[model samples]
Target: MTPYIQVVTTVADRTVAERLAAHLLEQRLAACVQITPCTSWYRWQGAIEQGEEMVCTVKSRRDLFPELCRAVRALHPYEVPEILASPVVDGGESYLHWLEQELRPAKED
Candidate 1:
């Protein structure tokens, strides 16, 4: 099993944020997701741009990152979504275990 980590991505709007979070959690791609509204300023097409955005902080296992990235790319509206991740070195063991279970795909007996 891969270690757990947090993945961060920003969406252009609140509706997209909600939808993406739902899709990730529903598909077991993420254990939890948080959405925060913020203002983004960056360079786009060689020009400075600013806009309101919703940042999605996703938590899941490292092994699922590739799958999660692919999933995000498929549905994301931006030409490039900020898909970044950081490792979780330590945490409450019980909570970590719960995260693992929460993101597990259901099995058929």
Candidate 2:
């Protein structure tokens, strides 16, 4: 497995995406979160639906995936949110090191 991964999820609105991003950063679950607006089409409840959405890309270490999934699910509004992780096959050595550092949990006394 690769040392890093990017977790992607779509939210109904920009506000939701921003909130989720902020929460993840505050929790140190992600090194960075990028939110982008896009149009999406998919089937739900046997019906095809189309809407404007915000896509959130969360960058973090591969080992933190489980926790990242749980965090996104807890903050996501959709009953069946689209959460997927793609491995970073190769990245800048310094950037990868920074990502790993950012995801480390805070030390407790």
Candidate 3:
């Protein structure tokens, strides 16, 4: 079987982060999501800047990434939201299996 994965999305606001978390889980795009509050430091146009943000760590099967990404894009409030996905190289077999099962579409037999 293919690897399960965890995608990390950092949003500019808490409400947007919560909404994205809800949308992904409700649509079965993710098995679980963890929202974290973070102080973001970066450059937007040119100068260095900082802001408050919330990050969502979403767990799912890697195969569902495209659909999951699409869902985030559709529901995201930002003009360009940070959607980052990473491979789950190693983990518990049962947990990975569950991730796959959770991400599988109901329309599939």
After aligning candidate 3 to the native by TM-score, how far in Å is the CA of 46 from where it should be? Answer: 1.2
lDDT of 1 by residue, 48-91 (tens): 99999999999988878889999999889999889999999889
The ten-residue window of minimal lDDT in model 1 covers 100-109
Q: Name the candidate, 2 or 3, with the larger TM-score value.
A: 2
* CA shift of 54, model 2, Å: 0.3
Q: Which pairs in model 3 have colliding backbones?
A: none
Q: State, as a TM-score between 0 and 1, how close model 1 is to the true structure.
A: 0.91
Kindly list the per-residue Cα lDDT of model 2 for residues 7-64, writing each as its tens digit: 9999999899999999899988899999999999999999999999999999987767
For model 3, how does the per-residue alpha-carbon lDDT over 1-109 read when each residue is reduced to its tens digit?
A: 3467789988888888888888898888898999999998987778998888898999987668899999999988778788898888888889777777777654444
Candidate 3 ranges beyond 4 A from true positions: 105-109
Q: Better model by lDDT, 2 or 3?
A: 2
Error of 1 at 81 (Å): 1.1
Worst 10 residues of 2 by lDDT: 100-109
Off by over 4 Å in 2: 105-109
